[model samples]
Target: MNESMEAGMEQYLTAGAAGAVAGLGVAVPLGAVGVLVLQQAMRDRRAGAAAGAAVAVVDAGYAALATAVGPLVAAALAGVEAWVRLVAALVLAVIAALGLLASRRPAPAGTTGTAGTETAAPARVFVRFAALTFVNPTTALYFAALTTAQGDTLRGGAAGAVFTFGVFAASLLWQQTLVVAGGFAGPRLPDRARVWTFRAGYGLVAGYAVTVALPLPAL
Candidate 1:
């Protein structure tokens, strides 16, 4: 097959096997991710399992999608042909620094489930989380690194396209799971308990920052 020849020749262009595996690692946050999860748990305690599930879904969805298509995204960037190293480094440094700060921020009032006496504003809450998460700079770094590493694998035309679709599917599956769980837990938690739950959540964020920056010497 003509495609087979292209596949064979492609190995010469990039890291291939090792790079594909590495793509997954670039987004594996040892620190901030946990903090966010815990924070979500605390915030959604009153929200019931559904709220928690939603948080998880969004988190996992983004991560998995970022991992799978990272290569394609990076390839697009490679074309920019600018001072990429400098740019990536600067961006990463700022993100790491911000993570440290975000960890220390005061937890917001209200459990994700805790609703105003008026008909609960589910849409607004969902939108709020989306905005907060999408704005995080570290997310950009994670995706950038992943895509850059996967860029080679994604160049194989049809095979590459299939891989990206699989990645997207996996991401969506994980995120949706989280959303369902959060929704279930939304209405079960109490007042004071929810507040400290989030403090713990922020603590995890702080932890993530430390882990990413220092990367505890591999055991």
Candidate 2:
């Protein structure tokens, strides 16, 4: 019995490490979401931290769900993938437009410091980031694919739980790193440079949205 328990623990740890790798694989890509996180961090460290946490929360939730019911969810979403992609693209475009508009606005009076021109409340920032992350079905689809591919390792129960926990922990670590890095660099940048960064970030997001909205060629 002791030997069996030890083997089970070993399996759990192995599965967890695999999950962390999968999480990092998905999170390391610096896309629209990454740019938004960095922009928020540059504006206000608190908001940046909140945004990062929110993204991590969504990622963790999606990872858990994918591990738990990946096959069923993927099957269900397969039929409507195009529509979901379109909706996600539209949402991203709107967010990019809003960010561009916000960037163009002048900083308010009496707001002096490296805090930048943060107009949104912390709670609002968290919710907005969370919602934006959730709307991108690709995150869920990526997890589902990973879970489906790792059938043997993620055979449910304690191993699955440990794997999910590892994914969440890894994602949080990556996001917090981005937040910290952005916060550190933000203060050093001049106001004009910051504005250009915002514009560039928003423009990139719009480009990403357009790419998502475009149809893929048949294989």
Candidate 3:
């Protein structure tokens, strides 16, 4: 029994390492969502950290689903991809509009409010990030492909759980790094520069949303 348990533990560790690699592979790409995460970090490290956590949570959830029932999840996602993209695009547009409006507002008094006007509630940040991440069907598809390619080695039971945990951990680490870097750089920028950066970020996000909504050829 002890030997069997030890072997299982070893398998879980191996699966976990694989999951970590997969997580980093997906998270390292500086997409619109990633840029927004950096923007959040620039405003407040805590908010950025929360956004990072939310991203990890969504990634882990997708990883877990893929590990458990990859083919089924993939099929479901394929069926709903169009609708999901539409919803995601609309949500991003709304967010972008809000950001643009906020950026145009005059700065309050003498203080340089790097944190901006958005509430820094971790829960709100987490939910926002999670919703943003979840709407992208590609994330789910990516997890499904990764898990399916790995075969049975990383599928189901304790091994799957460990793998999902690893994904969450690695993603969280990457996000934290972004948050820290953004926080470090945000305070140094002049008010005008910061405002312009915010506008640029909003425009980029809006562009990404429109791109997602369109049926463009995948790069």
Write model 3 residue lDDT over 105-170, tens digit each, in one string: 665655435534443587898998998888776688799999998888878888899999999999
Task: Please write out the lDDT profile of model 2 over residues 56-119, one tens digit for every residue.
Answer: 8888888888878999888887767777788889999998898888777777786743323555
Off by over 4 Å in 2: 112-116, 216-219
Please give, for residues 1-219, the per-residue lDDT of candidate 1 as tens digits: 889887765643333333333333422333444334333533443332333334434444444455556555566666442344334334444544554454445544653333222123445545544543444445555645655555555444544544444443443344444445544554465645544554455555444434444523333
Global Cα lDDT for candidate 3: 0.83
Report per-prediction Cα RMSD to one decimal: 9.1, 2.5, 3.1
The residue-level lDDT of candidate 1 at 1 comes to 89
lDDT of each: 0.44, 0.83, 0.83
TM-score of 1: 0.44
Q: What's the distance in Å from true for residue 217, model 3?
A: 12
TM-scores of all models?
0.44, 0.92, 0.86
lDDT of 1: 0.44
Residue 212 Cα positional deviation in candidate 2, in Å, after optimal superposition:
1.4
Choose the strongest candidate by TM-score.
2
- Report the error of model 2 at residue 1, Å: 0.9
